[model samples]
Target: MTRCRYCNRPLRSARSIALGYGPTCRARALAEARAKVIAQHKPTTIERAQELIEDGGIVPLRGNRVWRVVSTDGSTTHKTAGQVHAWTAGLRGRHTCYHRVAAQLVALAA
Candidate 1:
């Protein structure tokens, strides 16, 4: 007898046997797989930070730990330190901005 991939329950139906998952487990696995795919395609904060770094938008301030980050639109700029905490709307809470992320990447490279 075949067993479910997720719950380890017996798979009696031909479809379940072919899929190796019971009906409930198959639905759960499919949902999980869809969520994973969506997460992979979504633009994350770290990816945005990396884009800022790659675009030469981050510059150190006066040999200090502070950095200047330009917006992608080139209409605004923000100053942040390597350890500064910023509020991100997308994150809905306090988080580090691209300036700080660029600084951390530079530090790691050095």
Candidate 2:
């Protein structure tokens, strides 16, 4: 039996176009997509942080420690390293290295 990607519910039919996602999952996905489109039109804190990181205004800290702050274009500072560390530590796979965290940060910033 194929399982839903978002909710892990069993697929009721093989002909279902939304193969792995259940009805609730499909609705949630649609809602999230719509919200993302709306969000793109407005500059939120996340968007600003992404711009700062992409513009090289933020640099990942050295060593295995997981906390760093970056200066924004207006001399404001944004901190994301601690959040990243906490997220990575909560993962079930192999322990995440500092390099992995750095890469993830860069990706998130982008």
Candidates' C-alpha lDDT: 0.65, 0.49
List model 1 lDDT by residue over 5-85, tens digit each: 899888889988997888788778767754543354335755776788788888877575667788658898877655663
For model 1, the local distance difference test gives 0.65
Q: What are the per-residue Cα lDDT tens digits for candidate 2 across 4-110? A: 87777778876443546776787676577545543544335446545654566545555423334443335554444522433334344344333233334454322
Q: Which residue pairs clash within candidate 2?
A: 4-20
Global fold similarity of model 2 (TM-score) = 0.33
Clash count (model 2, backbone only): 1
TM-score of each: 0.47, 0.33
After superposition, the stretches of candidate 2 with alpha carbons farther than 4 Å from their true spots are 43-110
Question: 41 in model 2: Cα distance from truth in Å?
Answer: 1.3
Question: What's the lDDT of the predicted structure labeled candidate 2?
Answer: 0.49
Say which candidate scores most in TM-score.
1
